[model samples]
Target: MTAEPRTHRTAPVVAGLLTALVGFTSSYAVVLAGLRAVGASPEQAASGLLVVCLTQALGMLWLTARHRLPLTLAWSTPGAALLAGTGMVDGGWPAAVGAFCLVGALILGTAAWPRLGALIAAIPVPIAQAMLAGVLVSLCLEPVRAFAAHPLLVGPVVLTWLVLLRLAPRWAVPAAFAVALVVLGASAARDGGVTGALLPQLAWTTPELTWASALGIALPLFVVTMASQNVPGVAVMASYGYRVPWRETMVVTGLGTAAGAPAGGHAINLAAITAALAASPDAHPDPRRRWVAAHTAGWAYLVLALLSAALTALVSSGPDGVVETVAGLALLATLGSSLAAAAGPADGRESAVVTFVVAASGVTFLGIGAAFWALAAGLAVRWALSFRRRGTPSADAASGGAERDAEPETDAAAVPDAEPEPQTSTR
Candidate 1:
């Protein structure tokens, strides 16, 4: 039998550009929402956003280049929101940057310590899925509410986009974004207001760091970035068949975090859903050639980061409703899949139930969110059940002493062999 040929295909510049645009656009609202929650002045928030985009782009570039894989680096959207809410209220940009540094150090520390890294890796997939779902559920709901408010505007566009996605999976998001943009522009023009005013703006602020800020802002920012963002980000790469070393990826992310933190870059980590968009077969069936597209994205990010003012102007000037609606829709598929995957198999029903409920409950304790708690609860229940089963004496063992005597030997046999120890010679 003959093996099939492995074809190499390259990602187009336009595709890379589109990927970055979608990535930035989808997360932009979260940035704004976070900034507002934290009480940042419009100027500080805008400057912070610029720093975030630039750092994210650079992190993405360095990792992708090193691994020859499409490893996307992004600012933690959730972390940003956390900082905007907590850090902003407490200390402002200084606190937030301090949080960024702390978080970066923690992530780097995890990478340096193999035991911790292994433990993180050992987290069951289902629990991770549940946490991800819980976080994204609210985000996915926004588009639905937006459509209800303006059916004539958002309804037809969303419906059309869904149909296209079903019929042409690869082109769905880009096409939908295009259609929505046109409709929004036309509507704005008809209303006698220029539609092009919603583009992003460029803003830059020098870094300011303090101890209080670092503890209040930077530490939490780091935790969310590593736990929430990078964990899933690495998963995206694994799903796409790129098995790069975690330590290297962590180091790259750490460097980016350190470089951009002082300038207001909160936390940088791998991309999960968005990176998958560029890494999957949809981007290019050929794995080897896709590196070109990822490289393109990295360079593009660098340009945007350096030219922060222009990029900020472009996004800020665009129609708010259109951008939000489109981003919400784009994330719908990812949100659903993550939730479903987290639920686990039917046989593990009770554990799965606990995982979902706790994660979705939005309960937070001791500065940690529901995601961490859900996994903990589920794991505890699973282990308890397993231990109980193991401890129970079998019915056959109760009937015969001989069978009972054999059990220990069987258990011993089942135990895995340990590696041989090195010998020290005595002269």
Candidate 2:
């Protein structure tokens, strides 16, 4: 007999908390790094981070409530890095925000147009995989660097993570984090120096709009976020059997961006890898049930962002060596699998290579980075080959043979059976 399906009735508060913690912890470093690269003051960057996190949490909550799916939203970490790096060269924060608005409009437009959406969907899977792999590479590298800096702090954390992965893969990340936290607290107590290391304090920054900033920063930021972040994010949902409306999701993301941009929130998109962690069968085979977890994360994000100062202080107080190392090791398996999947199959190998090289190359043109270029190049090659093959005739047709070369071999195997057996004498 088939087992009865389980129905989920968990509170949204839990789901929100889970969503927020997962989103913030996973991407906070990258966001702060971007802010520093772009020359934002520490206070401005901190305020911006809070704004982005809060907006993203609200957006995810709103969308998930409406769809009843475990849809998680996130700020574009890579896109932010690109903005921080390139925006400084182009114009500044104003340009970046303008570019973001433009990109949002484009994403909304694409969602509105079925044809455009289909075109975006037609991007080769290998290229997408390659891009994802490239992004995960840095995550995998972090643990090694952290360990190198403080073996005493990071070593035990890594060891604990390995033990957890061996025995309980499902709880590996959280378990590793918990272990690191314990070690850090013990170390802090032993050292007896708790003067400056405290909870983060509240900070806020108003948005500054400018034409040069829009062209230099916002446009590139938008391109990278949509191409590198949102595209793969949508794929993650589809792969996991979520039937969310792409257009509505994009519109919501746009709304989130508009709400938070002035406050230093960069582009926000759907979560790709992080969502996979919480939505996978490991979390719960039942799709409906995982919404509880996602909703929990969202609520958590709201609380954390509101208490930005406290959260920031806590993170600052932690031993970076332990936290960074643990985070890196925790994500290694995911990173490896993503890279392997992206490079799969000989037929799409070239596309995958192009995607990886372009994304990692750090090349930019027309205020667009390599992610879009890689996709465009791979698609062009794929289509050209298909068009070329369409002009060629089959061997059987060219030979004018009466028998069809395309016929199945099984037809020949059954020839003798085509004739019926003679009737029995008893008849």
Q: Which consecutive 10 residues in model 2 have the weakest lDDT in total?
A: 418-427
- Model 1, 363-416: lDDT tens per residue? 555544455566678778756754654576563344346534543432222111
Alpha-carbon deviation at 91 in model 1, angstroms: 6.3
Write candidate 2's Cα lDDT for 1-427 as tens digits.
9764343343333444555665566556557556644555555566667877787788877877787888888888656545433424344555444555565665565555534443433444455556645544544566788888888877777787678778986556666666666776676667673324234433434445455455445544554565456655756776777755666777788777776665666778878667775566655657777776666667777777765544344334566656545545644665566567566555436657776666556456664544455556665665664454446466324432432341122122111111121001011
TM-score per model over all chains: 0.66, 0.66
List candidate 2 stretches off by more than 4 Å. 1-41, 64-89, 92-103, 178-242, 271-297, 314-327, 330-334, 363-427
CA lDDT of each prediction against the hidden true structure: 0.58, 0.58
For candidate 1, give the lDDT of residue 31: 67
Steric overlap count per candidate? 28, 36
